[model samples]
Target: MTVIIGHNPNFVPFNGRGTLRHNEPLSKHTSWRIGGPAEWFYEPTDLEDLAQLIPQIPDNMPMMWMGLGSNLLVRDGGVRGMVILTAGLLDDMIFLDEYTLRVEAGVSCAKVARFAVNAGLTGAEFLAGIPGTMGGALAMNAGAWGSETWAIVQGVETMNRQGQHQRRSVTDYEVRYRHVKGPDNEWFVAAVLKLLPSTIEEGQEKIKALLRQRGESQPMGLPSCGSVFRNPANDYAARLIEKAGWKGRGVGGAYVSEKHANFIINQKAATAADVEALIEQIILSVEQQSGVRLIPEVRIVGEYATTKPFMSETPSS
Candidate 1:
């Protein structure tokens, strides 16, 4: 990890609680390895430090939150203001009551699954294949093999940009497939999950099977967002993409995985522009051919260049 302290000119070096970097390369943070610099990148040391820093930032300055970058894309021009990266912070995991667990936002989905299984929890086995953090899983209602993040949700802890906190129930948010809409300007910091009881052996075998399925069907070795498009109702995005003959197509360095048509991989040196162009093209093609507009599962942010890459050419998939 690239850690540079006191690098941003606008950085206010308070106590030694966290690290700050100016013009931090977001490419280093995202899964695609393809983004420009962030004006100010802040990684809090802990949840306490993060909450403390939240209400102190300038009101005029903009901010964004992100996880492990498994399903996100930042444009080549980069983010303009502070990016509060939670990928490294908020990783506290504790087993609570017999049927409940407390997982901080930064904990990876895979870890949550393993921890739950070790404690003899059964419902979280589906999370073993998700590539992002629990916070991201919460944001997107991430799931696999018929289980969703919100399906097992019990209660969630949230904090507004202003540092105001709230403990909300599952009903507090409008949850859907690949979507979660809740309070404005409030992001997840932690969650309390209710799960079932099972033996560690059962959990381990289930996780292994899920992982094996993912490895066989997805491009695990390449750098790519886990899934580029949400599966449409009654159908899969991969099916639509393949029906449109989009498998192995690409924009610059970004190519659709042969293993799964819905995934875009960075074959070599992929730019954010390259990935964005590919996504737009795929959306257009799929919609034109099938009369269905596929919504992006990937969260795209930041600004793109006025001119695009030489995307008319293709890269070898």
Candidate 2:
């Protein structure tokens, strides 16, 4: 297989029943409203379509799987190969039984929470505050309010690059805080989650409360990734950043959110480079001041832009 950089005219044509486009802008898909273009972007209509399409691409071509695009940063230079967008394309949610729900990777986390509640289930209320999809939640073990995604997972369905599917038990993977490791070269396609019984009113009330708390604490209605840094063991990332006096600091259009120190807001027209620079600054400053290095919870990818110069001004707090 030959590796091609950008816009390969010799790439294999897709014959799936989904949308496929060349040089698709990623900014329209992400929560942060940032990113450049993808060399090849495909949105599969269903699991079958995705499986059929995977094997058509050359093995050497790069591939990236994305959900709602929270907790992600794509560089201005854009992605080089194929990007498979699952949000709104692979959506399928159904109850496997009275106590279990089968959710596809493209279903939003908030929708899953509401669906679980509508089914009189209790444990998924925490998912109401998550901004991404079920696939991302499962991949990162995304959690909030002390409840994690994997705790309720019974089993998962995965698809490899060869268009093959496998059903895997929860015990097949090693689950951790904001991390999960299972079979290599495979991505989650669906999951069966087990939940406890509860009244609809009770579950709705919990979800409402969680959303209210998130609205008040987070930078609501802003162009920003939810959280930039993971809380280190026995210490909060926000606390360290605030203590180190980084709150409301700005680099180009990206600024450390005044409301939440761990959040970097695109105040106005912030580029991906600005966000990355601010992230680096926070990491360096927090590590120097608190003697603890902060790890970014958000995933950063793609190549740096060679055309633009980084701005030097810092915005007002």
Candidate 3:
């Protein structure tokens, strides 16, 4: 098999798709509102349009898939190649059966939660409060409270670098808590989620309560990437940070959220570097003080301008 990493094919323009200049600021794509630009950025109208452009793209060109960018952080140096925005192109959500739903990867988690509730489905209200698209959630095995995204996923439709698509079963993955692994280089296009039957009113009530809890516990109004670190062992990351007395710690525009210890917020006009530095400081302090190493839950991508600037204080978001 040939590697899809080296050739550059000319991209013919299509209707309902948009392309931008090289080095377009990545700040426009992330929830953190930070990042340099990608060498190329493309937003397709639909899956057909998306697939058409794939073969034209060079094999070695760095390709990054983007959804809502809620769980992502692109650095100041920007990305090297193509960044495909999936926000509008893959937003389909449909019923496959009485207890199963077909959801496109680009659909927002909140939208899916509402759709499930309106369709008399339960077990999906946990998605109501997540601030990312289904694809991002799937990539990160995004979870909250007691539920995770992949738990209800019965099957998934994925696309390869050559635009070849396939349907895979849940058993195909090595699933774990907040983690999912399958065939490499195959990204999710859609999912068939198995759900339980429930009343719309009941689901709505559950969503409301969850949202309320998030609002009270998190810095709901700030620009944050949600939880900064994964919980360690049986302990919560937030508690450790709070115990370290790092609350409200600020570096440039970023600050340790006074409201939630696990969240680092862009309090002012914070740069990506600001948040990055703060994350590191927190990790060093926590590890030195409590001997509990924290892991990040956020995805950090793109290049950093200075030495050793990429690794976060903890794990991937």
Q: Identify the leading candidate in terms of lDDT.
A: 2
Worst lDDT window (10 residues) for model 2? 308-317
Tens-digit lDDT string for candidate 1 (141-182): 998988999989899999888777789988889999998999
Model 3, 205-268: lDDT tens digits are: 9999999998888888677888989898889999999999899888999989888899988778
Q: In candidate 2, what are the lDDT values of residues 153-192, reduced to their tens digit?
A: 9999999999998999999999999889999989999999
lDDT of each: 0.85, 0.88, 0.81
Ordered by TM-score, highest first, the candidates read 2, 1, 3
Q: Which of candidates 2 and 3 reaches a greater lDDT?
A: 2
TM-score between model 3 and native: 0.90
The local lDDT score (0 to 100) that residue 32 gets in candidate 3 is 83
* Model 3 segments more than 4 A misplaced: 1-21, 306-317
